[model samples]
Target: MTTTTSQATGSSAASDGRGARPDRRRRGKEGPAVAAVPVVPAPKLRRRPVLVAASVAAVCLGALLGVWTWSSTSNTHEVVALRQDVTRGETITQGDLVTVQVGLDPALKTIPGDRLSSLVGQRAAMDMAAGSLVTAAGVTKAVLPSEGMSVVGVALPPSLMPGERLLAGDLVRIVATPGQQGDLGQEPPATVAATVVGIYPNGENGETVVSLEVPEGQAAELAARAATGKVALVLDSRER
Candidate 1:
């Protein structure tokens, strides 16, 4: 029994020694290692470059806006030459620029160059076609003489179209003579002189009426001539 006990005690001591050796070796090899913890992510190196670019762009934009504001505030421009139609027909008023048939000198019937400045605001003599003449009568002024003259509606031949050539004031002779005589076949021609006040053309009825202003006493004879004999228009010479 003693021998078995001694062998058993010796085996246990050997086992304990072996275990202690292994534990000491393990502790020495490890050398007090610390527990592993979660590592923080490194910051992106590209973020610095992106932030600097954004700052520069913002500064540039601010500078550009400042420059634009300064230029607009101090800018000065001339009031370029502005030509507008001062006169127009009854349908037109001031501050209106309508494409009208302006008059050109009759001598310039055919233009050598393509530019035709004079034919801008002239109204048509008749219902104008493309190649028609744009005379002074074509376009009408938006205004008229309020106090100096007036218009009268008279029944006259259409062939006697005035083309609206009568101006503000004009004078001529008015005649009213008996066409046939009672004694024989001859009668003395009678005539008188009056002033042209206005011009009225009847497009619908194909009639041309001349508004005239003359002595009040001659209104009777003038009306009589206008009613009986054919009314004739004679333009006064510039000399008179």
Candidate 2:
């Protein structure tokens, strides 16, 4: 009975050993066990040209916005300007003036546009061309027949006048012709200086009546010349 028991125990031990070997063989055949490794994707490369273009676009937008803001903040002012040419001593009227918007400048002194009514009937201190900006220095209380001056009207026949039309403020000379043939050769034409104040056409006589502003002392002489109908006008460019 003891021998049988020993054989049975040896068989049991052999079976156990066999089972362990198979498990080891199976593990070896399957290959070594491996731990899972985490995979991390590399970062995408930056587009340098696209980044640079985006930055430049942002800068340009900023500059344009700044310029727009500055322009909006600046303001303009209105001032009075001449609608038509005004001669020295001529009156200012609402029809002869206009309002103009101008950039504000501290050095520029001009009549305000709102003072249109106050400037009316005021005489011009100087000859101002059309579209000129009205200023404080260009106005006066009175300019007609200024001190020590007189206005005289002279009738000039077309034959005795030049083709160029006479205008106010023109410097002219009136030469007196002799009344008789005997006196023509004896004396040269008497000349006098005058400023044209106004001119009117005389359709009846086909003549032009020119009102001249002359010195008080010479008014009588110019009138005498006009009465004789022997006067001729000579434009003086040097006085211009």
Candidate 3:
């Protein structure tokens, strides 16, 4: 009975020792338990190239605005401008002139404001409208009927004149046709070159009275020819 009891006790001790060895081996093989950590994704990379492009565009626009503002405010001058419409050969009076401040372009020639006084009494070389800048090519002292010239009025029907409308400063010639006295026939009918100085409607005959500026030597002859109602006005291609 004692030996049987001792063998049972030894068997129980061997079973306990085997269980303790397996537990110690498992503990050594596994690492210590650690608390679970929450995972966070990294922030997406910033769009650096897009940001740089926007900044450059803003800077360029600012620079352009600054340049335009500077140009508009810089380098201006005072010059002469016409205050009224002056027809060719019409005299310029004080009421016809005005001064304006403008930025002068190197390619455009302009008359100075100080010359406004000198422009008075001079005739316009061509038709100039209001708000036009007065230049050296605008006015001249050469009158339409200058020095030794005389103006003669001729009554002419529209059909006997050129098709184009005639104004002052037009170059024209009077061609004599069959007069009331007799036939001018051939002989190329005497031609006299003249410049138009004035024009007006004559009565209600649909005829126009044109004032021709001709030399004093030929004024009487042309007037006599026009009185016959056989004179025609020829417009020359010369422009003012």
Candidate 4:
């Protein structure tokens, strides 16, 4: 009975040793067990149609504005302008005008630069300052000394007239002054309404020769008073 027990123990020990060797050999060949790493997909890019469209529209509008600005600045017109000051009824001349380039509205009445010849002999209808644009209604062909009007030349000393410079279209009154002998009459001073036509220097004397346009009926009387150097000029309201 003891010999049978020993043979059974030896057989069980050999079977256990064989199972342990196979597991050790498998572990050595396979190396250490590693945990798997999870793969993450790349994040998808979201497309915003509104943002893209706005960018495109902005670029187009910028280009359009640039083009419009360039076109507006390039567009210009040649027109007539005054090179010097011209008084009312003064004849327009070539030397009095200049050709200028401007971007003007169509509603503005400006004379064309090419029509300078047509305006040379015409008269100014109103007072025009230097560098002013010439207009159609600013010139005329009417005679200067109109019907029923007479122009009288009056030479006045500085004391007889205002110190202010007088223009051609200025309204004035020629008032008769008392002579050195003095007036014996008690009547009010005789005053004649007149318009200044032109002004000229009276040689070396400190006197101004003013051409006065008055009614034909008053011309002779005004001339007699002016010749005596006993008249004073009073400026009237210049407003039209």
Candidate 5:
């Protein structure tokens, strides 16, 4: 009985020793309990070289366009402009012109403000409105009523002239009509070629006073016919 007890004790001791060694070995092999670290998926390395370059290029282009627009709009010029309304054939005085800053087109013809002094005493070739830009073709230096030409004023009712509006520089003919007695055997009507110079409306008498430029020799005859009020106006073709 003693020996059996001894054997049983020895076996139990051996079993316990084997189990403790295995547990110690496992603990040593596995390090301290590691804390779970969240893995942030390595920041997705999506490289878009084309897209990045395009974005950069777009920003640069926008800046360049803005600068170009500013430069274009800031370009300005000092030019001459009319300060008041001026009728055809009227002389341009200092008071009639002003210097102005403007952005002018390349194709536009403008008289520079520096030439303002030169424009004095020059005649306007056509009717010019207030605030209009003075151009090279707007003024003339030619002596009006050329040496052989004489200006005559003729007043006529609407019935004796064409319905079309008459403007300065129009070519016209003044024709004499028979007197109220109506002479049947009278010679052909007399006609005088003339150029329109100025037109004035006579509101009180319902007549238009037209200033005409005619040959010096014919001026007296045209004046005589016009005084009798038996003449009509014929507008000639204005082409060229």
Candidate 6:
């Protein structure tokens, strides 16, 4: 009886031991972590590694964006840099110091298409607005033929014809007949050319006075002709 009792106790003890060991295993599996967690420090993921990774990603994205923009902007047109002295576009005003398309030379007096050749240092009058057609007249100044000359006139139709009858811009024809010369010589025939000059009023003869110039060599001949010749008045054509 004692032996059987002892055997039954042994079997019960082994079964209880096995069951407690399984409970201990379950408790170990349910435990939090191997290290003791402290209340002082809050758990935080490693931030520097994540931040570095994010920065690297941003730099990569920016580089790609910049490359895309550069590719799109590849096509470009030509650009020209204008110099301060070189003229091109029209200027706005006469007082405008920043002038362009200047008429450097006025005497070039070229025809229509040649106007550009002269616009160097010369300034333009206000009437020459920019982009407008620069006519030959607009680019050049008008010149009167008699600006520089000395003139002298004598009476025509013998002595009494009035000088007031003549005006400038009028054409005249000169005629001369031979005069008494030294004993055996014949006087020279009169020489003539068309003439137009400004006139000064001459109340002395109750007529206008006119001025004329002669070549130094021809003055004596002209005077001799004037002494013996007739001066006739004619009209000039207004067309030219």
Q: Give the count of colliding residue pairs in each prediction.
A: 15, 0, 0, 0, 0, 10
> What range of 10 consecutive residues in model 5 has the weakest lDDT sum?
178-187
Which candidate wins on TM-score? 4
lDDT (Cα, tens digit) per residue for candidate 2, span 1-240: 999999999999999999899999998899978899999999998779988999999999999999887775566678899999998756688899999877656777788889878999887878899998999899877666889999999999998887887766788999987666747775577899998877789999899998899999999999998998898999889443
> What's the candidate order when arranged by decreasing lDDT?
5, 4, 3, 2, 1, 6
TM-score of each: 0.34, 0.63, 0.59, 0.68, 0.67, 0.27
Scored by Cα lDDT, where does model 3 land? Answer: 0.88
Q: Among all windows of ten consecutive residues in candidate 3, which has the lowest summed lDDT?
A: 179-188
Tens digit of per-residue lDDT, candidate 1, span 116-164: 3333332222233333333345444333323543333345664443444
What is every candidate's alpha-carbon RMSD to the true fold? Answer: 15.3, 11.6, 9.5, 8.7, 8.5, 21.4
Off by over 4 Å in 4: 1-62, 87-93
Evaluate residue 23 in candidate 6 and report its C-alpha lDDT on the 0 to 100 scale.
Answer: 96
lDDT tens digits, residue span 95-170, model 5: 9999999989888899988989999988888889999999988999976688999999999999999999887778
What is the lDDT, from 0 to 100, of the residue 74 in candidate 6?
62
Ranking by TM-score: 4, 5, 2, 3, 1, 6
Across residues 4-103, which tens digit of lDDT does each residue of candidate 3 receive?
A: 9999999999999998999999998896998999999999977799889999999999999999988876877788999989888777889999999898
Whichever of 2 and 3 has more lDDT, that candidate is: 3
Q: Over 4 Å off in model 3, which ranges?
A: 1-57, 74-102, 112-121, 126-132, 180-182, 186-188
TM-score of 4: 0.68
